[model samples]
Target: MNLIKPHDRISLAEKIGRPSVALVVDDFYNRVQTHPTLAKPFSIVAHWQEHKQRITEFWWIALGGKPTASYSYDPVSKHFLAGFNQTLLSDWKALFFEVTHTHLSPELASAWQQRVEMIGENLLRQNDKLLGDRGRPST
Candidate 1:
């Protein structure tokens, strides 16, 4: 899928809103568990089921643009600091796009893909600056 235009992103995010975000999280977690590269890292968590549900809720909150009374940590950094690396990130994003393509409509999938690509690009940039280049060069 092609990257979504910036103007379309807001509408796409609105389309996803809360429920779609929950569905994406649920689908993503299931895919992660089944994925060979991701399964092991996911297994490291003590409460996989609970963690998965919380992640789903977290996405709902994030995409819904709701105000947060409680502080929430960024899971990507949390995982990375815990030793998850670029390989995992790449694999996860691959699976994520796969799931998105399979589950969401083309327009929604394009929007989500663009958002994810943006986030992934930023994360890779930060990771490179902090840790030095540890994987293939960022696209």
Candidate 2:
């Protein structure tokens, strides 16, 4: 139940071009990869080039575009595996909005903000639920 108004849910694929998405993904990851709290887990990423491509594809899909060919990364699993605690997720969300604000107009940024918040919160909740389940015995 996303309470976001229909008009606030503009298509990122249509409003923001793929080139802009690519740029944001590149810039965002560049910063994240070097971020003190984010760097270590990302160090396991063997190929920066491929990782960036996958990130771009992820943004493309998230922004309401058709799925990129074979872009199937599960963000929650990856983040959980990498031990992303609440503080790390908060930092990541903060940086994400900062990057988006730099690239988009206020309206577009606001629109994307709602969507991003919803997605991030959902992922965090799901990750927590799954982690909790892991500690319980199977039925």
Candidate 3:
């Protein structure tokens, strides 16, 4: 009983809205903060409040919305600076997909995960350089 179909691209921002997006981001970060392997890399980020706010805006714009100033940070560089390795990135992706699938419809989750995988690929290719976001910048 899915509302979406193949080749049907909808506005995820409109589908999920800001509140749901916030909830997903909160849950994702909260889970990551407590993860045994992932927690170490994120431990340097003491400003969880601000990080969550910026990340929420990042997802909002990424999912399909007007880009806010807060969403302009380079995620790949940030992760590299946080000392994220390949295993950490893989675990992070797994956790992200788990959290996203929990919050979004299957169709929406698939679409978002596709974008994330592409971004992850580009991030690996760029090697700590800025890959930027999906909506405004090229991956």
Best candidate per TM-score, number? 2
For residues 28-74, what per-residue lDDT tens digits would candidate 1 score against the true structure? 88777778888887877688677766766555454545543454657
Q: Show pairs that collide, candidate 3.
A: none
Q: What is the Å distance of residue 51 in model 3 from its true position?
A: 0.5
Best by lDDT: 2
lDDT of every predicted structure (CA atoms): 0.69, 0.80, 0.78
Q: In terms of TM-score, which candidate is stronger, 2 or 3?
A: 2
Predicted structure 3: clash tally = 0
RMSD in Å for model 1: 6.1
Task: lDDT for model 1, please.
Answer: 0.69
Which of candidates 1 and 3 is the stronger one according to lDDT?
3
Q: Which stretch of 10 consecutive residues in model 2 shows the poorest summed lDDT? A: 130-139
Query: What TM-score should be assigned to candidate 2?
Result: 0.82
Q: Which stretches of candidate 2 lie over 4 Å from their true place?
A: 1-10, 133-139
By lDDT, rank the candidates, best first. Answer: 2, 3, 1
